[model samples]
Structures are given as C-alpha cells and as structure tokens.
Target: MGEVDPAFVQELEHRPKQGIIEAEGLPIIDLSILSSSDATPDHSQALEGLVKQVGNACRDWGFFQVINHRVSMEKREKIFNASGKFFAQPLEEKNKIRRDEKRVLGYYDAEHTKNVRDCVKKLT
Candidate 1:
C-alpha cells in the first residue's frame, strides 16, 4: 500500500472509556531505617524496607528508581551523552537507518519509520 496520511490516522475513531480520576498525593516511605552504624549488622533489614517502598510505589505510581545500584558513574555519564547525541542529530540523518528496517541497529523516528534519510548519510 502507499503512504498513509498522518492526519487520517489521527482522526480514526475509537471506543471511549471512563475518564481517569485525579488522586491526591503519593504515599511517603520512611527510608531512614536503611542507614546506621550498627543497624541489623547486615543489609537484609535495609533491603526489606526498600522492597516494601518499591512495591508501594509500583502499585501507586507505576514506576520508581533505585538509588544504591552499583552501576558505575562513568557508564551512567556515557549513557546520558549517547542519548543526547542521538536526539541532537538532524531529522534526515536519523531516518537513514530507520529502526524498523534494521531491527537491531540504526536510528529511526519515534514511530519507527524510514521517511527522511538524508542528513546523516551526507555527514559520513
């Protein structure tokens, strides 16, 4: 089939659902129990507390981050730099190796299509 008009896609009708109800605020978890000179003599107590907090957050907000993970600072920096570089590229360059076609490699639009593939090819 030929290219589909984006406007048409956007206008396609769909079933309606009940509106979401806004909630008050997130529940607070006490993390102070995780730190001390002689607290429990092992990380088990701290870990248990964290697990409970994570479970609550997951149920209430659907997401959260762990602060004490052992990933190196250097690796985190590299990830941030790489993500920024990818987003900063010209639109044409990004579409050249679209993600859908390459599957495991190449850049593509957020929806995964190869449309404007020009800028990056010219750079290299």
Candidate 2:
C-alpha cells in the first residue's frame, strides 16, 4: 500500500487489462436448485439447465459468479482472512514451499501470459 515500484507500474502499463462487464450483464449462476433431492421431472430438467448454464458461462467467460451456494458467510470470511494472512507473508517465507517442475503443489509468484511474465501469486 506504500509507493509502488515504478518498474511494476511500467510493466502494468504495457499489459492487457481484464475486460470489465456491467454487473447486470454478468453471469450469476444460482445454486439453490441443485441442492434439492426430489427426482421429479421438473427437478431433472432444472438440473440439466443448470449444468448447461455453468458450461456456457465457463466457455464464454473465464469465470462466473455463484449465488445461493449455501456456504455460511462466516466460513467465507474465514477463508478470505486466511488468504490475506498467507499473501501478507514475506516473499522468502512464501518461497519456502516454492512450486517447481519437480513439485507441482506449492507457492508460485510468477504467472506467464504468452510466455511473458505477469506478476501474480498463488498457493496450490
């Protein structure tokens, strides 16, 4: 949150930004219907429709928002807080579990776009 490195800003200036879509136009998938166990014809049809919606959303948009997922807000908040704490760690500490060719399930900081380094980080 302090002064960002000028070099980082320069890199961002040259990178293609993600397109923003209006909230109303965004794909918001409802998940409540999938929770029902009734084997009625209507339920089966609705489930099939839901599956198609998810597929289309994934194909057209890289991601889609979900609703009525049934996850409690408290659990969601805890996950967010934990992620914040993890990302807040110093670089060296994060690298202690560095992801590499030999190990595909750990921390990584560099993301490549068309083989070009794009600044990003993740722990898998």
Candidate 3:
C-alpha cells in the first residue's frame, strides 16, 4: 500500500462532542460495619454476611466492594498502583497483549473480534 497521509490519520483521531448531565445520587453504604472488632461473633459469620450482601448488591445494582477483607493493605495499595501504571502506558505498548492473540488474556476493547456469547461462556 502507498504511504498513509498524516492529515487523514489526525482527522480519524478527532473525537466528537458529548452531552453532559448533572444528577444527584445517594451516598454509598458505610462498609465500616464489616471492620469493627465487635462486628461478628467470628470470621465465618462475617464472611457469610458479606457474601449475602454482595450477592444482593450484584443482583440489584451489579457492583459492590468488600472492605476489611483478608487482602493486606500493602498488597491492595500495590495492586492499585500497578493497575494505574499499566493503564497509563502508551496504546502501542498495551496493544502488544491485545485479546485476539488468545482466547483469553490481555486487553479486549469493545470492537474485539470474539462474539459476546462465546466470550462470556469462556469466561464463566
């Protein structure tokens, strides 16, 4: 193919305007209840309560977080930092592990080749 034109590439990269909306929302539930020394009779009870709450949140709103879990503070902080760094990397670098290279693993943008049903089945 002939050499691509730089101006054409720049135009392709341009983004269109988006509408904005302001909305009020309720505060998230306080998770400190899971952390207190007197929170539950034992770890098993605490875990059971958390599982029920998480299941309800998943079914109702599709998202939740479990605070005061076994993951150490240092490990969680490290994971957060590492994820931020990975996301901040240049697109070229991230694309090295793009999803089509495997049935699983790496980045899969919305335009990924695999069908949604197949991907979900494989993931599950």
Total colliding residue pairs, candidate 3? 0
Model 1 Cα RMSD, 1 decimal = 10.6
Q: After superposition, how far is residue 20 of candidate 1 from its true place, in Å?
A: 14
TM-score of each: 0.39, 0.67, 0.47
Identify the candidate with maximal lDDT.
2
Stretches off by above 4 angstroms in model 3 are 1-50, 111-124
Judging by TM-score against the true structure, name the best candidate: 2
Task: For model 2, give the 10-residue run with minimal summed lDDT.
Answer: 15-24
- Quantify all predictions' global Cα lDDT against the true fold: 0.57, 0.78, 0.55
lDDT (Cα, tens digit) per residue for candidate 1, span 1-124: 9985553342223311224223535445555544545545466767687788889787655555455455688998898778778778998877776777437677745442133222322211
Q: Single out the weakest 10-residue window by summed lDDT for candidate 1.
A: 115-124
lDDT of 3 by residue, 22-111 (tens): 232221333555566675468668667766776766654445545545678799779877977886799898888888744577865554
